[model samples]
Target: TMTIANSIPSEENNEYCNQFHSKYEPKEILGRGLSSVVRRCVEKSSKTEFAVKVIDLNNLDTNSEDARQDALKELRILRLVQGHANIILLHDHFETEAYIFFVFEICPHGELFEHLNKVVRMSEKRTRGVMRQLLDALEFLHSRQIVHRDIKAENILLDAEMSVKLTDFGFATEVETDDCLTDLCGTPSYLSPEILVVNMYESRSIRVYGRPVDMWASGVLMYTLLVGSPPFWHRRQMTMLRMIMEGRFSLDTPEWEEVSEAAKSLIASLLRVDPGQRLTSVQALAHPFFAKQELPCVTFDRRTRFRSAILAVRCLCRLHRAYAMPARLELRRLRADPYTIRNMRRLIDNTAFLVYSHWVKKAEDQNRAALFENSPKMDLAAQDSG
Candidate 1:
């Protein structure tokens, strides 16, 4: 477990010494990945909390200029993308001699990975909601010509209402066309077959694959959500690569049987071996699975689940900052206390239900009124079209 040390007065030798301190006070370390460490910080002026991803360049494999170029590319891509709900908002960034700092929206509930582990397989409805949010984010990225090479549960963050925030653009790259890319990157299990086979051994002379890589990852995520594990998992790396090449998957599991056929069909479409045949974000959105669902109702009560979760996290964060205690200790205490988690979950559920119900009723009323008002116009259009 990562520990958060008390904030000590910065010495002149500290790498962050040169960077201008934002109004937000530094709080605690969130988690560390291969090249970066995330810390929970708050703006002193606004008292708004944020997550800061501090990337240590020294840790990167700098044997060649390729590593530097990739790092610079990620920074550039993130800077290019602005406000989008499904995407994690990047507030500000700077760099020092040792590290690059990226301040982002603080997600309280943590990674989707943890959430998936805690719950049994989510319902098809819940899965659809998450998929919708993810597609929205991905669609936005694809529109900007950015391909998030890595898309997995761990990279998705959840707010209090369990709203999805697509994050970690470390492996993302901009593409000019639907070309096959030979970059051997991303988590092993989520790698598309073309990437795994073509990119791994043949370092050069491989085609440039585009956005489909992301779509493939989305399929893997869908599979994990519905079945509770990756479709392809092997004890050996060689076997896993072979399985991926063969496009072999088994849907005979008991858990797989329980998932809706519509959801399974969508996953199958997304997991197509040929990138061209895979479902585009827009096509996936138009599928009956998503089309049948009502527009997401945004209500104060509906927002409650997330609000309560955020509040609890904020409270814990405040306590951690004031007391200078380890974050793991705080999390353990909160997690151990069933009352805290349950109350928070209930608050979100109840609030969401109330908000959704109110909106639905309002929509029906408005819909009826609109039908009467536009009756003549509707009849004319129907007749003209006919």
Candidate 2:
């Protein structure tokens, strides 16, 4: 039984900090920034792992009041977007006199930025999968009128399976339908032209710039994922801002030669100078680029069911052997019989062939069906047959 303390009153805040430590054993620091450090923690009772972000209130670099407010704002936004699949889960939070702790679901693989650093670049298939999850999370946020003002690679975390878990809502804010956000926030390379225009020239010409800013950041992220570098980056900060403002990024680079035109087109649409002309989250999700890159949907039939049953039985058999053979000597003495091994190998080969065959057949069928449905001749043939 975990006691979830939503918030501790100012008077009892210090006392609750002890309670948090009692419930969870804080471990090694996972990451660190100027204002905060995230550490791995394990709940005492259940031993479930979590990530705890501890924000220092006494840091002279940042105003204590503003830091506290930012922490509270992140808590509110995390709660608002709770249960979203692609967004990071906030299990609990605690605030003390000197620190505020945010307990989140542990993403063992760390930030997308770190992953991209290692891989340098991702294949179109991998990029599409990452983009899809990111866009879905963004769409979920936008639906609730919440803008994730910061959507850089550093803020995006990855779980064990490499699924996107969007985090760091410190800059997130809820906007009404007609509201215009003038805040010049987010990473420099990922910031939209509208934000830069306002930031540099203090221009009031861009009357509306809220959710579209997120779209622009997402576009930058996609470009980064595909090309291994930000599209608008420059050696100098001012030069980078100028490039972003002028929309001077080029797809003519050698890195982009292998990228599909559909992807380039979507990036262009998202990075449009006019925020109004930029694709919304929902529209971006519907882009042809993703459609082309997505894997074919798998439909389970009798053969798949049979193959699953065989695999399940094999797993059970392995479990049975494990339970029955505690001693290494006994396990070595009663090894898998030749008959059993042969049958297992045959079953695995058959299963693989059947699964591959089924997938190829399904994809071909889907493509043929799509073509036929779109053809006027097929429609006339149906009419004649009727």
Best by lDDT: 2
- Candidate lDDT (C-alpha), each: 0.72, 0.76
| Residue 264 local lDDT, model 2 | 94
Residue pairs in clash, model 2: none
Number of the top-ranking candidate, with TM-score as the measure: 2
| Model 2 CA deviation exceeding 4 Å by range | 1-17, 202-204, 292-386
* Model 1 RMSD vs true structure: 20.6
Instruction: Please provide, for model 2 over 215-237, each residue's C-alpha lDDT reduced to its tens digit, 9 standing for 90 to 100.
Output: 99999889888866677755466
Tell me how far the alpha carbon of residue 355 in candidate 2 is from the true structure, in angstroms, after superposition: 43
**Cα RMSD, each candidate:** 20.6, 18.7
Assess the local accuracy of residue 259 in candidate 1 as a C-alpha lDDT between 0 and 100.
Answer: 67
Against the true structure, what is each candidate's TM-score? Answer: 0.70, 0.71
How high a TM-score does candidate 2 get?
0.71
